[model samples]
Target: MRNFALLAAGALSLAAVATVAQGVEDPYIWLEEIEGTRALDQVKAWNKSTEELLAQDPKLASYQSRARAILDDEQQIATPDRIMGDLVANLWRDAKNPRGIWRVSPLAAYRAGKPAWRTIIDVDALGKSEKQSWVWHGADCLAPAYTRCLVSLSPGGTDADVVREFDLSSGKFVDGGFVVPESKNTAAWVDADTLLLVGDFGPDSLTASGYGRIAKLWKRGTPLSAATTVLEGTKTDVSVSPFARQDGDRRWTFLTRGKTFWTSDVSLLTKDGKVVKTPLPEDASFEDIIDGRLIAKLQSPLTVGGTTLPEGAIVAYGLADIEAGRSVAPELVMAPTKTQAIEEVAASENILWVKALDDVSGKLFALRRSDDGRWTQAATALPDNSTVRLLETAGKSDTAFAIVEGMLTPPTLYAVTASGTPAKVQSLPAKFDAATMTVEQKFATSKDGTRIPYFLVRKKGVSGAVPSLIHAYGGFRAAQTPGYLTGQPYRAGPLGMFWVEEGNAYVLANIRGGGEYGPEWHKSVLRENRQKSFDDLHAVAEDLIRTGVSAKGKIGISGRSNGGVLVGAALTQRPDLYSAVISGSPLHDMKRYSKLLAGASWVGEYGDPDVAGDWAFMSKYSPYQQLKPGVKYPAVFFYSSTKDDRVHPGHARKMAARLNEYGNRFYFHEYLEGGHSVGADHAEDAHRAALLMAYLKRELGGKK
Candidate 1:
């Protein structure tokens, strides 16, 4: 097998400099120029060629059979939305009570632990709302008591003024409401009574440049007169910490911002009205802040340690001078030297907990302050090799919870003791028993000899080929690993279907583009090595078919965001390998993606299309650019939101139009308000999951 590195080099060399010089053309232009008839013909030709290749490759045939077996097993239960919902419910249950759900926005809370203190709020009598959809954002909680909690409600999803607060104690809503008349408000809690809201001020308030000033802080009850300005407008970048903390006698807020392309700022806002901002070291961008003082800053041109980081070394940071209030220059700590990534960080006054990624597996570490005030580290926990997402923690308890799952293992919640022992706290409803389910790991050699890892989950008694769904995301150094299973209601129920109950789904951890194997793995397929990513996905598909998990005609693929881009590239490059594809809020037109908001910042990962060398590497797999003249792709579903300022919704809109014009069967659903996520409320999420699963069932052929 050729090494992935060698193959990436070879692929990069194949594209010509002249062709790469075209730069990023407006995707709208491509949509307008490419005649539907001509595009359809090109898609057909590509699909036919790929089918012929698979037919000739016996290995590919066998892998497809294995994939089918996994998908076809009849004994497994079906429940799509059940997974996510149950997972959330279980986490709430383990928190003991009064827990709230937090998400990515207001980066401060996300880092500080958006959900914040576990027992600080109320959690009883919680139920999903009917009118609102995509409830992930636009919600806040007030800690009325340990058993009494009040949750802010947004019925018009995340973008409208719709505001109502719920009393978890009595499972009813309180009457006082605040609705912004001219703009939409997304709420965040600064304290029980204070809200930090982000929203457009109104058309009249917008600048001449078509940009509007979105306020970052607003007091709920106190008059604006008493409030302080945290962030003034859109021009000044701001992000909140995931969690908040008190240092010495002051309450501190940590955030990162960029005033220009070359310089980024990380600052600490003290409660006493003083802002301490530090410029990132020249040529470096701050990724995240782990502990309050330990910062994860990436230098221009990101590089994983030449080797993968040792197990438990995923989170890297530069120590700052505690007393001096500044980062120590030229110092790197917890740097991984191999295929690993620091995923999460949790700390107390005396110790810090860090989670590291090794391929698709996870490891945890405990670092403590020494007598001399230095840090000492040691591996404290090693759960069964699987995918893990940290759930919650009790302050200074040294105890934490996580959701763990594997290909065959349904996701389940587990509590980790201070001693690091994992105790199963709750098991998702088992429509199928683990004893009857078979889960295994298999590797496929990439075009270059790099082994790509994948997992197969199926029923034990099932025989022969079955329809299968293969999920993958081979970009942005993200990894897909095993974890606890979400119930069928969350996974398939809302969709009027169920999991194995519906059929089988496979997860592929493709190589060269994820943190699974470390920085080296990601580098092998980044930018110029982009083709390697598509090939890695292709290799996994072939391996599944060869193993008899599924037949060529029974397979489907799904991904979101960058993962969505992976699906786009694969569909364009190897449509024969899948019967359907789901690309959600995907960054498909890579050549021009960076031009979007903050897109320029990611050049470190995706490469600059304007540069000759990089463009040569990107053009080969740039999904939109690679669409052929005569090919028929499997039915594809493209979903995005109009308010998604992060990755422009234009990507999906253009791709959908292009595919439709080409006479291909595809579905396009754009939400008008939910921001980046198409769903805004619980009901919205349930509906979206249903739609996605329904589409998969229709294309993949589920429980008849």
Candidate 2:
């Protein structure tokens, strides 16, 4: 927005959601009309005005050029996406291919840096041929042979995408193959002829959150209507998605319904032609099945067969035991510590890979199960301050690819196997010179005396306070860690490259509501406690000021989506601390947030505003509702994409309009397309980045 992996009432129509004000007098409600002519006209005007302000800077073109070059650098590694034996596939995007291309290359040739890549699908070429702006969502293929594949393409980058069957070997879409029309859906291949699907079947098919609640088994050569319902969930549920796990010749299919954002109901379609539900806690997450054992992560303390596993513990259960209707007895795999939390867990046929955050630094380890079924871990020698993650696992193979990189280091792809140490396969070329830059881990005490960690990146040999920018996401249990700012136009890392290169400091805060420390770190900031996340951001800014790292009024905050709320709250609550705010695809107008696109699904995180109790706490800090007259707020820039079906652009639009009504000054911009990322192509991204650079420079007094 995989932040594509990234969600109102009962499937509310756009028109109905836009019109319902929930008893609040919203004069700017007209902006909620997503595609309404008047609303779009106003958006155009605001975009123009923001452009005019940023264009006043003489170096706007230069800034944009630098940003575009870094984003489109051809020297960047063609990261392996799906690995199948000797053949590897990836989505490649560069100057020539803006939309990207799904291509395959031989493993040996690829490792040698000269691979014969077969273009399975040239997205830019296909878009030109079809006269449509098709953004490549992804491609899922059958394992082993990997000839047949399902390709998803989004129109203008919406969450809803068209799924079509393609021939991976032939590099062509099958003429009489399967196709699902544009809708938010989940699909998995049970076999070549059978697919388990959860998508918009029709009017009553989708849940209240606009995701499919009904799961069906679709057979080849039959109408989608002919598919039989395999499972179903309530409309109030977040959604039901299909997941398939394969080991050797055995494959198990399951449907997981999100009872809430934090809970799930896992139903397995057994080989005996029976559907069985696994009795797991509402706060537990099923990681995957490995070697006939069920792997799960606990978010809270759970008593399983008289053994209570602490929160953030990784445990295993016998698949046969779970399916046999026996009391769920499990084996403890990994326990939690105050400073350690399991960030990722994935398994190949033979080895289990786990990536954990120890004091905000990434550590990788491999696990092996003994004959007695007890698992032991072997810690890897990967350096600290880096984000290590598994990229892809080959079918029935003991090998997988892992990416390792940090704030100042370029991302390198490594091939990990059960036998030996990880070997580097490819490394991304350095985008910016880091000789002058330095990275440091720092702590800030929040309002409740809770210790918060953040990464501070800046030029070395600095004596006095400097202008600083802080980027953070304090929601959704998504752990924010150190990584290079080198993907999408907004490869937002805890630390930024261009800003640090300019001698201005960059801060990446690991505030509450993130999975940095564990489930409790995120759970501590949910619903009524949401304001604490905002307070954590303020604490970081104050800490910087107190430490003489950044002076008062020399600080700035930037966040997109959930991060948007953080900066927005800071503007209204602690405006005097920061000098500028950039809120992108943010959530404001807390009262109407539930009715907006995909807003209802997030009620578990933000709480239901329609409820009087929820609104009591929300209204106190809702930036839009808290906007007052004659308050000296800092320089603010709000951006959102009209085509972003996930987070409604109205959040940014209505907030800016309210500020304008109060005669408060702010910068607002809206892109007609570009989906959740805000811009589609390099030009659009460069333009936006240029504006951001100019705005930050002017407002923060950075000599750029």
Encode model 1's per-residue lDDT on 100-124: one tens digit a residue.
2421122122223322222212323
Candidate 2 residue-wise lDDT at 534 = 89
The number of clashing residue pairs in each candidate reads: 118, 1
Q: Each model's TM-score?
A: 0.66, 0.94
Error of 1 at 563 (Å): 2.2
Q: After superposition, which runs of candidate 2 have C-alpha atoms over 4 Å from their true positions?
A: 1-24, 111-114, 324-327, 395-397, 485-495, 702-704
What's model 2's TM-score? 0.94
Give the lDDT of residue 243 in candidate 1: 26
lDDT of each: 0.52, 0.81
lDDT tens string, model 2, 1-704?
00000001111223333444555477678788999997887777767667776787898888788778876888777887877656889899888999998899987787566778888899999999999899988888887678998899998988989999999767789998999889998889888899999899988887788899999999999999999997889988889999887766777788898988888888778766467887667678888778887788989988866768899998887777767777677688888678998988887888877889899888887888899877788887766678887677654556667788888898887777676477777788777777778888999999999999998988888879999989888999888887885441143321256577678888889999989999999999999999899889999999999999999879989989988777888889987888888888998888898888788898989899899999999898888889887886775788888999988899898787666654456777788778898777776777677788788887888442
